[model samples]
Target: MASWKFPGFLIFFTLFSCSFSYTFTITNNCAYTIWPGTLAGSASPRLSTTGFRLDSGQSVKLTTVPGWSGRIWGRTGCKFDTMGIGNCETGDCGGKLECDGNGAAAPTSLFEITLGAGNGQDFYDVSMVDGYNLPILALPKGVYGGACNATGCMTDINLGCPTELQVLGGNGYQVGGVVGCRSACEAFKLDKYCCSGEFANPNTCQPSYYSTIFKKACPRAYSYAFDDGTSTFTCKASEYAIVFCPNSNGNQKPNPAPASPPPPMRRPHPKGHVVPSSSNIVLLPFPVPMLLLVVSLSFSFIVERPWPVI
Candidate 1:
């Protein structure tokens, strides 16, 4: 008679898939305070807060579900009360600190994103369609695919804004003293610049004189209503950093990652077995190969019993 214990089974299994939450770290490098306003698209979840103040050199980290979509912009020169009511010189949303799904006012630099969009990709862009109030940059992290690229208006467009399109701030000022730049549509209100009526279609509406000025200043941003060829950027990234008034030193040095990373994604195992933190290996107990061997051996042993040696 021979006795044998079960052999240890070695199974190669694919790592369990986990759900990931995307992160957005908004940083302000401006010399003044900026009230960041956010608005979620239809079917998207609102962020932790709709609006908040970010002082110079300060930053805020926000986490959103993978499929969330939204837009963000800075509201300059805002005066808010204890009740969260306020007015902003630009990008005001209902005179409140929190936008609560309200869109920012026109002539505001816009950063928009659709996370985990079609085919697990993110579509993002900085648009001067409304206008330009501040410089912006969208930096992607852990990017995959060739589509990953940085997009934003790093230049201070207000400095070179045309006289007619310049939005002056503070006391009376001369050329090169503007704080914001108005889009052609905002400045002229023409059907062509506004992309309305006869010029509503892509073929009909084209970039205008004012739009050309903006395009030359901020080549990466949307200068007109249908400026999409180079304005929009796409990528698959784990996180993004949206910076306002990024330094123009051209160094583009790497900065430390945000202190808070999104929570680890998890998936429930069928057997309710918890995964060990130390290992990335996933074990499947009683795999098909081992189960079949056990069944075959049991049948052979039963057949060879010889009817109790009768």
Candidate 2:
């Protein structure tokens, strides 16, 4: 009887733990290799890995505790030694292979998320507010219900990047071509572009010509500092897939996919919620009764099973 009790409790514990955690599947769908980096928010716990090399077509899974909040980005044109010491052409974090809590540099596409606690909706978005280094697509998987619309910027903004804001590839890899597109604020540090100083309020700060260019190209991505209305998304999902340089068709052409409709307006974020400058945060109650029922049934079956006496 004692041995059976221990096994039953272990099974229940495992299932309960799985119910609360969420999985992030990070994939490199680009033609070239990319090193992905992750940065946890000041209040959130860090993931198991801060960064790692991911070759084309490779995917890695990362699990996070409930309510984990962080940002993920890809670094391109990286050259590292045996000790993983080197820098990437774009999205480099302190010139190290493993970012180790370092945030990505400007001019990089970012996938930011603030996961909710048990049975709560997650807020996520692919942001170009920092700029655009590579195309990114974020898709939520295993959504129990509610609006789990896919959000991302698949357009290769570098091709049409304004000359002043273009980040040319200094390395020989992309010579004579733009490798990244800098935001107007990043290119020119002004009150209007940066949304700082007296222009901090949404009413005072408006979109610039450069921001319009990005918004027109990628309708779903966050083009500027306060692009929350159309850019932020919420979903109660078991997993999320963040694809870097996603190839929609069979080829490498960076064709944009049809934008998903904005999610229905929901309640505002709870008090004390940390809203990032580039995105507005929100939450929804997750349906956990069904999940709990399934776990309970499994636990009961395990406990009732007749065991051969040792």
The candidate scoring highest on TM-score is: 2
RMSD of candidate 2 to true structure, Å = 13.1
**Model 1 Cα RMSD, 1 decimal:** 20.3
Report the CA-based lDDT of candidate 1 relative to the real structure. Answer: 0.63
Q: Residue by residue across 1-310, what tens digits does model 1's lDDT show?
A: 1232222121112121233456777877666778998887765667778899887667777776556766889888788999999787778899999898788886788888767643556667788788877878777776777435667776766666666776776622222456566777767767877888888766888777666666666666777666667666667897787777774222232231111100010111012112111111111221122232223223211111000110
Off by over 4 Å in 1: 1-19, 171-177, 248-310
Superposed by TM-score, candidate 2 places the C-alpha of residue 294 at a distance from the truth, in angstroms, of: 33
In order, what lDDT does every prediction score? 0.63, 0.69
Worst 10 residues of 2 by lDDT: 300-309
- My TM-score estimates for the predictions, one after another, are 0.72, 0.77
